[model samples]
Target: MPQAVRTAIVGTGHRAQLFTEGLAKRDGYDVVALCDPNSVRMAFHNRMLLAAGRRTAHLWPPARYDEMLRVERVELVVVTSVDATHDRYIEAALRAGVRVICEKPITTDAVKAQSILDTVRETGGSLSVAYNYRFNPVHRRVRQLLADGAIGTVHSVHFEWMLDVSHGADYFRRWHRDKSNSGGLMVHKASHHFDLVNWWLGAEPHTVYARGQLAFYGPGPEHGYARDYVRAHGSSAADDDPFALQLADNATMRDLYLDAEGEDGYYRDRNVFAPGVSIEDDMAVLVSYDTGATMTYHLTAYSPAEGYRVMFNGSGGRLELNVEESTFTSITLRPLWSEPVDHTVDHEHEGHGGADPRVLAALLDGEQTEGAEVADARQAALALVTGLAANRSFETGLPVRTADILKL
Candidate 1:
C-alpha cells in the first residue's frame, strides 16, 4: 500500500460528509478527486476541504468516474452514494484494483450485492463496509459480556428499534422512501440492527418471515399528517410543521442541498406526508440463525422517543439492553440464580455515543477496532442476507429462506 491512499469520493451527498470530514482528521488518506453527477454538490465538498485548510480536489462528473481513477492515480474509492448506486461505484473501483470503503447496506438488494461480491473474488481487492454501530462502547461491551458467556448459550433475541419523528420522517422524505431505490427500511435502515445481531452472536441468518406497512408516512386522509405541499423549503404549510427540515437553518444543509438545488433540482426538504412513499414505516421480522438462535425484531419509524431495546434469552439467563437516545443506555446481565448486574454509559456525544469518531479512525486511519469485526466484502454481504430475506418476506407474505437469496 502507498503511504497515502489517493482516494476518490463517489458521491457528494449528506452521508459523504462523514468520510470527507473524517479524512481531514487523519493522515495517509489523501482525497484526490470527487466524482458525482452534481457539480454543485462536488463544489460544496471542495469548499469544506478549503475551510479545513486542505487542498481542493478536482471534480469529475459520473460519466468520467473511471477516467478520474486513472487520471488522479487513485488508490482508494470511498462510496457514499445513493443506496441503489453503491454497487456500480464499488464494482468499478474493485475491478480497477482500487480499494474501497463503502457506507452501510453495501448495496440495496441481492443482485447488486452479488455483483460486488463477484468483483471482489475476481480482483481480490479490499472493500470495507462501515458498520459504525459495532464501534459504540455500549455495543462493544455487550459483545464482550456475551463472548465471556455471561449470558451462556444465547437462544432467542427480541430487538425493537424506534426512530423518532425527526430522524425517521427524514427517510420518508428522502429517496429512501422508494422501495426500488433503497429496498425499503429493511435494507436501508435495519441492516445496522441485523448486522449488530449477527456480530453479537457470531452467527448467520438462515431464514426470515416479516410483515410491514406504511402506517404513518405517505399522503392520504387516512394517514392524518398529510400536508398540502410537495416539499418543505418555501412552503407556508411547512412553517408550522414540526417535522419539516429547514435546510436554510443549517449551514451544511443549506450549502450542500438548498444552495446547490439550482444545479440538480434535488429537494433536500421534501414533505414527509406527501404522496410517493413506497416504503413502510412499521415492520416486524422473525429470523432463524445458523446457530439456532431465533430473533424477533421490529422497527417503528414514528416513536415518541428514539432508541432500541434488545433482550437475549440464553441457557443460563437473560441479558437486556435499553437505549433511550435522550436519556441513557442501560445493560442488565442475569445468570441463573444470580442477581442482575447493571451497567450504564454516559451518553454525552451526539454521534452514537461517540461511535462515529472511533469508526472513522478504524476506516480512515487504519486503526484496529476492538469490537465486532469491521465488515469485508463477504461479511458485508452476509449482513445483508437477513435484510434481503425480510424484504422478500414483506412482499411474498411468507417465510424466505436466507440460503435462497444469501449470495456472497
Candidate 2:
C-alpha cells in the first residue's frame, strides 16, 4: 500500500469541511493539521472530524503555519483560505517545497496572482487549483463531447449564471461583500465559469470587456428595502426579512459561524442591503479567446433562481446546457437540430453538484477518472487574469487585454 499523504488544511471554513470530511472517507490521505486564525473555527472542524469517525487534527494558528507545516511534515497543503490570502499561503507553501491544492480564483487580484505564478515558476512546486466544476459528471460529459468534436470548432459561447437570494445573499453577508477581500464576484465567483470556458474550449482568454453595478446588495433606498440592523442574529429588524440568513437557525451554521464569531468577530449574517458593501451584484463580460472564440457571460447574484445556462456555438453545431439547482428540471443538454436530452445530475454528495468528492479523490488519492481536468498554476493564473481584466474593463469602460493585465 502507498503511504498516506500527510495534509494540512489552511482554512476551517465551510468549504474546508467538504475536503476534510471527504478526505476522511478516502484512503491514503490523512489530514494531520489545520491552520486557521480562529481557534473556535478549528474546534468546530475538529468536532466535525470526530463525527466523521476520523482522528482530530492538530490545530495551529495562521501565524505559525510555517512551523505547523514543518512539524507536521505535511506533504500537501490545501488552501481554502480567504480570496486575498490565497496567494500568500500558496507562495509560502511553494517556498517551503510543499505541494498545494488551492481553491478557485487562486487570488483576488492580478498582483497576487502574478506573484503566485512567479513562485510556481521559480520553485517548480506542484500546485493545482481546485476548479471542481470540471469534475461534475455532467460537465465532464460536456468536456468529453467537446473533445469528441461533437461541437466541432467552437466559435462563441454564451453563459449566464444566476444566484438566487439564498445563495447570493450569503456572499453579501460575509467578507465577500468587500472587493478587497473577494475581488468582487467577477474574480471570486466568475473564475469558475471563466475556467470552465477555457477548459472546455481548450483556449486562453485574450481580451475582456465588462460592465457591472452594485444594484442589488448595497446601501440605497432605490433598492426599496428599509433600513435595519447590520446582522440578522438577535435583530428584530431582520426577523421578517426573507433575505436575511439566520445563522442560529441551522445547527451547522450555528456551530461553525455563530459560535466562532466571538473569537474572530466575524458575523455570518450581515444585512445584504447594508451600506459599505463594495462588490457588484450584476455583471456582464465579453471575452475573446486565443482560439478565436468569443464569449459573452453575465452573472447576476440577485436572481430568482440558482443555476446556469451555457451555450457553445461551434462550426458543426451548438451545444446548450441548462442547469437549475432548485428545480426538478435537472441538467438538460441539447445539440442544435437534435432532441433536447435530459441528464440526471447526481446530487448524492455535497458541494457544487457532487464535484467536490471527485476533486478530493483526484487531489488526494491520485485518482484521475477519464475527463477529469486538473488546472495548474499557469492555467489558474490565466483564468484569474481573465476575470481581473474583466473587472478592470468594468471600471475603465474599455476592453482590456489579458496579456496587458498579466504583463505577459
Candidate 3:
C-alpha cells in the first residue's frame, strides 16, 4: 500500500463531498482534485475545501476532471458520479492504472458491468465498490453471529426496508427517475439491501422472482398530469413545504442539484405524482442464492416511518434487526423528535446501530472494519449482480438467475 493514496474525485455531489471531507480529515488519502461537469457543483466543492483550509490548487472544474486524471497522476480515484456515468470514470481510472473506490450500484446495466469487470481483469487494477452498509457495526455483529454458528445454517432471510414518501420520492425527482440511469429501485436502492444479504449468507444470488410497479409516483389517474406539487423553484423553496423536497431550495442540495440544473434540467424535487417518473415506488422480490438459501425481500416508498426489518434464519437460531423507524437522511426534522438534533454525527452511539463512524474509520485508516467481513471484487460483483438480476426479474415477469446474467 502507498504511504498516501493520491486520490482524485470525479463527482462533486453530496456523496463526493462526504468522501472528500472524510478523506481530508484523515491522514492516508490525499484528495488532489474534485471534478463535475457542472462548474457550480465543482465550485461548491472547491469553496468547501477552501473553507476547510485545504489546498485548492488541484480542484478541477467539471470539464477538466477527466483531463486532471492524467495531469495529477492520481494513484487512486474515488468515484461518486451519478449511476449512469460511473462506468466511464471507473474505466478511465482502470485504464490509467489507478485503483478505484466507487460508490455502490456501479452501473445500471449488465453489458456495462461486464465491460468493467473485464477491464478490471485486464488491468489488474484494484476496484473496490463502496457498500458502506456492510461496514456498519450492527450488521457486522449479525454477520459474526451467523459465522460463529450462533444463527446455525442460515436457511432464509426475511428483509423489509421502507423509505417514506418524503425520502423515497426524492429518488423519482432526481436523475434516478430515468431507468436508463438508475435501473429502477431494485438496482439503485435495493443494491444496498441485496449486498447485505449476500455478505451475511456468504452466497451469491442464483435466481430472482420480483414484482414491482410505479405504484404511487408518475402521472397517476388520481393526480392527472401535473408536473410538480408545490410549483416552487430554486433553493429558497426547500423549506416552503416540509413534506415536499426543495432540492432547488436547500442550500446543500441547491449547490449540488439545483444550481447545477443548467447542465441538465432534471429537477430534483418534482412531485412523486408527476408524469415523468420512470422508477417504481414499491417493489418485492423472492431471491434464491447459490448456497441453497432463500430470501423474501420487500421494499415500499410510502411508509410514514422509514426503517427496515431483516430477520435471518440459519440452521441455528434466528437473528433479527429492526432499524429505528425514520428516514436515514430526511432533509427536514420529523416532529416526533423534539428539539434540534444532528442525526448524522451526534448520534454516533446509535449510528446505524453504531456502524457509521466505524465504517468511515475503516475505509480511511485501512484497518479491519468492526462488524462485517471484508469483500473483494468478486463479492462486490456478486452483490451488484444480484440487484441487477432482481431488476430484470421485475421487468420480465420471470425468474432471472444471477448466474445466467453473468453467464457463469
Candidate 4:
C-alpha cells in the first residue's frame, strides 16, 4: 500500500483552515505543518488540530515557505494565501520538488503566470488548482448532463450570482478591499464561477466582454443597522472583535466567518452600508467559448440570499441548477449563513456540493474513478486569464476575447 502523503499549508487563512480541518478529519493523509505570517492564526490552527485528536504540526514563523519545506520535509504544499501571492508559494513548492494544490486564478498577472508554468515544466512537479466546484455533486450532474447531451450543444448560458448586502459588504471591509491583494474579486471570487462554467461547457473561452463598478458598500446610505464594527471598520490597528465573532448572537455568521479571524486582522462582519470601501459590489460579463457557446454572467453584492442560478441552453434540451442557498456551512474569517434545505440527492458532502472533500480524496488517494473530467493547469490558467480580461474590458469599455488576451 502507498504511504500517506505528508502535507503542509503555506497560508493559515480561512481557506487554509478549511483545507487543514478537512485533512485532519480524513484518513490517508498526514498534516505535517502550518505556516502563516500571523502567530495568532498559526496557534489557532495548532489548537484546532490538537483538539481534533491529531498530532500538532510544526508551525513556521510566518509565510516562510523556504524555511518550512527545508526543515519539515513536506511532500505536498497547499497554497491558500492572498490571490496575488499564489505564484510565489506555488513556485517555491515546485522548486523544492513538492507537488502543489493551490487556490485558483494562479496570479493576477499573465506574464508572471507563464513564468510559473515554465518552472513547473523545468521541475516536473505536478500542480492542481483547487477549483472544488467541479467536484460538486449537483454541479457534477450538470457537467455530465451537458456531456450526455441532456443539454444539447450548449448554445448560450445565463449565470447570475448575487451576494446580499451582508455578504457583499464584508469584501470591502476586509483586506480584499485592495485590488492588488484580492484581485478585486474578479480573480479571487469569480474564479470559482468561471471554472464552473469552463467545466460545464467543457470548452475554452474564446472571447469576453464585461462592465462593472463599485455600485455600493462605500459611502452608501447607512441602512438603519449597526455595522459589525470589528475594530473601527478597517483601521490598521484594530484587534479582533469579540462582538462580531459572537456565534451565540448569530449562529450562521459565527460558523461561516467569525471563527477564522485569527490569521488576519480582516473582519468578516463589516457593515453592508459602511463608508470608504473600495471593491466592486456589482459585475457583469458576456463570454464566448470556443465551442460556439456564449455565456452571460452577472454578479451583485446586495442580494437577499447567496448561491447561484445557472441556466444552460443547448441545441437539444436545456438544464438548470438553482442552489437556493449558500453551500458554505462553517464560518471562518467570513460570516456565512447557509440556508437549511433538504436536498434530495443520492450523494451528499460538504462545501460546494461536497466538491471539497472529493477533491482532497482524489488528490491524496489518486484518481478513484475513470471517465471523470479533470481540468489541467493550462485550462485553469485560461479561466483565470479570461476573468482578468473581463475586468480589463469592464474598465476600458471594450470587448475582449479570451483567446486574444491569452494570445492563443
Best of the candidates, lDDT:
1
Estimated TM-score for each candidate: 0.97, 0.94, 0.87, 0.82
lDDT tens string, model 4, 1-408?
A: 766778888777567777778778866668898876766666667777887888888878554678888888889888887777888888888999998888776787666677777877889888887777777676766676667675457889899887765566567666777777777777778878888888778788887898888765665545434444433434432334322223335643344345545545456555334554556768998988888889899988767787777777766555666765644322111112333323234335456566777776776556663334445578678768777888789778998866555543
How far residue 385's Cα lies from its native spot in candidate 1, in Å, is 1.4
Alpha carbon lDDT at 359, candidate 2: 83
**Cα RMSD to the true fold for all candidates:** 1.4, 2.0, 6.8, 7.2
**Candidate achieving higher lDDT, 1 or 4:** 1
Q: Each prediction's Cα lDDT score?
A: 0.87, 0.86, 0.73, 0.70
Error of 4 at 259 (Å): 10
* Local error of candidate 4 at residue 118 (angstroms): 2.5
* Candidate numbers, best lDDT first, in rank order: 1, 2, 3, 4
State which candidate, 3 or 4, has the greater TM-score. 3
Clashes counted in candidate 3 amount to: 12
Relative to the unseen true structure, what is the Cα RMSD of model 3?
6.8
**What TM-score would you give candidate 4 relative to the actual structure?**
0.82
In candidate 3, residue 319 scores what lDDT? 64
Error of 1 at 261 (Å): 1.1
lDDT of 1 at 202: 93
Q: What lDDT does model 4 reach?
A: 0.70
Better of 2 and 4 by lDDT: 2
Residues 258-355 of candidate 2: C-alpha lDDT, one tens digit per residue: 99988889988899888879999999999999999999999999898888888888887777777788453344445668887665455444567778
For residue 362, model 1's alpha carbon misses the true position, in angstroms, by 1.1
